[model samples]
Target chain A: MKAIKVQALSKKYGEKEAIKGIDFMVEDGEIFGFLGPNGAGKTSTINMLIGLLKSTSGTIEILGRNLETQKEAIQAEIGVVPDESNLYPEMSGIDNLTFCGSLYGMRKHDREKRALELLKIFQLEDVKHKAFKAYSRGMKRKLTIAAAMMHQPKILFLDEPTSGIDVASARQIRKMIEDLHQKGTTIFLTTHYLEEAERLCQRIAFIVDGKIVKTGSVETLKASLHDQSGLLLKLDQNMANLKQSLQEELKLTKVEEINERSLKIVWPPDQELTPLFTFFRQKEVHILEAKRMEPTMEEVFVAITGIEHSEEKGGES
Target chain B: MNKGIALLSILNKDIRNYYLKPPNISWGMIFPLAWTLMFVLRSETEVDLIEILPGVMALSILFGTTSMLAVTITFEKKQKSFERLMLAPVSLYSLMLAKTGGAIIFGILNAMVPLLLGIALTGLRAINWPVLMGAIILIAVTSTFLGLMIAVAAKEVFEAQTFSNFFRFPMIFLCGLFIPIQELPALIQPISYVLPLTYGVDLLKVAVGAEGILSVFLNFTLLLVFSFGLFRYSIHRMERNWMN
Candidate 1:
């Protein structure tokens, strides 16, 4: 079952289209990553899905309920952590969570118990009594996440969850997300951290200029590339002459020498590797190490989008 | 039921924060006391001081409701906390009601200090307890609604301060606060009738035995109408500007 389904979702701010006819689906209990650079409609798309900003034209279904006609129902089933910490600074962390939980009609005792458990999990128990204004950036982020999870929402929408956290905290957060997924929570995450997406997400959708350009699982995407096979060959010394012979004899596509003792080869998937090894032994090429290379997500992304993975500029406040 | 729960939670949180900080409590109490002391010291005669007592009390309520409310909301806006409230399940109407209610409660408490001082200093007597309660409620409600209007319309803290003072100064001056509205020119009397603070001040004076209860009720009704109209306008503006 699809937990979140968006069809032709578009949002226009004045004359400019922030999200133009974007479509995607987040399957139940799956970790879905929404990938995009700055100003690439990632946030706009998430906002529309969560009913924060009305869509210009489209349909969004959360937990099989239409967002337009059943916004209250949809919101009740989903949790949202906006890009910014939208907490009451004058209130304590525990107070913030309890208030959020009460919005879902949770009993005071249950809400208090849940809030305390979450505060301890997020390592905020010591500062639970302190006002939110006194919390650090990482602590505030953790508190916001805990607040969202207070009701055990079925679908969680997290926008840039690890954008500003330290390395240790980011790892902890990733582990927490994994735990939630294990408990059958469907997560829809948006972030610029491609490496994080590659590590955690089961599927990813790349959006650009208000449209989805690509969507697939990591392995499926890597397999879809035209150049699916790579070879890393380490040769013994004084085997330079065999490189030219192997290229001519085996019809290799391209080869590059690495450090005068190693070579990298690009070949088609249909090509047999055993023949190359047999030929090398017959000609006595004196091979040291030869292994197949798995493609990284960066290469797959660049291949699919036709753009390099440069860092996003201009931080959003 | 959800709306009620959300409203109570928000109100309780606001009250806790307001009281937990001693500085806010001191400021709320001292502003009215200082104003009363200044009025007594600056008067040339005891009769003159007694005449200014009602005005000083009204002025204290105005400051407590308008300036303090505006500054607090300005800070919330700057911190983006108001946006957080908008995203919650609570209706905008309930949120506005909670905000206005909290501000009015604070304003009434602030007004009581100077009110008690005026009675002790001038030997002012009260005829009708019900009428006095009604008038106090009227003044607090109207001033709180007006404060919300200013808070919602202004974009920045400095802008909120300027916008509050722009109307508050004239309202305080012509509403029989520092000067009696009847002593003003004929053309200015019409202006005073339109200002909510004029009705508030008149109602307060009547409540303290300076006038009849009937006159106080009349002014209280006008202030009620002003408050209802302003509350509606502020809610509309807040919904339009922030809830999108």
Candidate 2:
């Protein structure tokens, strides 16, 4: 069953259409990456799904209940971690989590036990008694995530869950997300880190300028770029003569010299790497490191959106 | 049933964070105590001191509710914590009610310090228990609603402080905090009638035996109307602005 279904969801802020009519579905228990450039309406759409913002028009069904008609039911089953850390700074971490748990009607003892367990998982046990003002950015982020998960929600919407954290912390967060996914929690995550998305998400949708340009499994998207291929070759001697011969003899698309003895080539996948090896052998040149380069999520993203993903840095939705 | 539990949980958190802390609780007590001391020292005549005691109590409620609501709300807005609350299952009205209810409780507690101190130091006479309780409830509700109105109108902390002061100062001074409305100029007395604080202080003074309880009831009823009206307006405005 689909855990979340959004159809023709739209939101406008004044004259600017924040989320142009868009549609998508998140399957139950799958880590679905809502991939998009900054300011691509990812947060706006998530906010609407959570009932935090009213959509200009559209329908959203969460856990098989219409969001507009069954907000309470849907909200009871879902949890949201907004991009910003919205916990009360004057309160202790434990206090924030317990308050969130109480909203879901958990008993005090049950809430406290659950909160303590979550704090331990997030490595915030030591800081549970301290006020939020003293917490670091990473600690705050972790606490926010813990708060969102206090009720053991069925669907979790995590917006940039590991942003601005250290590498170790990001890895820990990724491990935690994987653990949640293993336990059958459906996660709808929005993040700038394509590597994280590539590592975790079963399927990703690349949104550009309020429109979903592409959506599929990572392997499928990579296969879409099957026609594009690159070759890295190493030579024992200078390749100036060989480079010129290849440029003239073959329909080389792009050739760049890495060093005096190495070269990189880009061409259609249909082109024979064996021919390149034979050409190198015919010139009495040594061949080293000759293989096809697999496409990175970054490359796939660029190919789909026609804009480099790095260009959207520091832009928030 | 769950809604009641959630509301209680939120209310409990508000009280602990806003009322139980040493700094906040001490500040709440000190303001009213300071005003009580001033009134005791300035009351040259025995009757005049009795009159000033009720005004001081009213002032305490004003200061407690307005500053607490403004400062705390500004902090919440800056931290974006209110948005998190809005995302919860509780309705917006329930959230606002919890906040306003919490502020009223704090205001009542703040008002008590000066009234107790005035009775102790001045040996004030004939305190009508029912009238005084009614007056305290009146003042706390009106002050909190007014504070919420000001907080909702402000976009930033500085703006809230400035806007709160613009009305709070005049209401404190002109609404019989330091002087009786009858002793003020005729035009100013009419203005005082329009101010919620004026009605509040009038009722408090009547409770303290400076005026008639019947007159106080009339003023108290008007204050109730204003408080409810402002509370409704502020809640509506807040929902419009923050709930999206």
lDDT by residue (B1-244, candidate 1, tens digit) is 3667767776776667653368868877888889889888888865666566667767777877887677777777787676556555655677778766777888888878877886687665543556656767777788888888999988898988899899899897787765677788988978988888888777666655575323655777788899889999988887566534
Number of the predicted model whose DockQ against the real structure is largest: 2
DockQ of the two-chain complex in candidate 1: 0.34
Q: What C-alpha RMSD does candidate 1 show over the true interface residues after superposing them? A: 2.5
Query: After TM-score superposition, what is the CA distance of residue A264 in candidate 2 from its true location, in Å?
Result: 4.5
**TM-scores for all candidates?**
0.84, 0.89
Fnat of the models, one by one? 0.29, 0.57
DockQ of each: 0.34, 0.52
Q: Is model 1 an incorrect, acceptable, medium or high docking prediction?
A: acceptable
Instruction: Encode model 2's per-residue lDDT on A135-163: one tens digit a residue.
Output: 99889899999999998999999999998
Tens digit per residue, CA lDDT, model 2, B1-244: 2777678877788788877788889989888888888877878876777777777888888888887887777768788887777777777678778777888999999988977776676676677778788878878888888888888988788887887888899997788766777789987888877888877777777777766423765877887799889889998888667545
Weakest 10 consecutive residues of candidate 1 chain B by summed lDDT: B208-217
Model 2: which residue pairs collide?
Answer: none
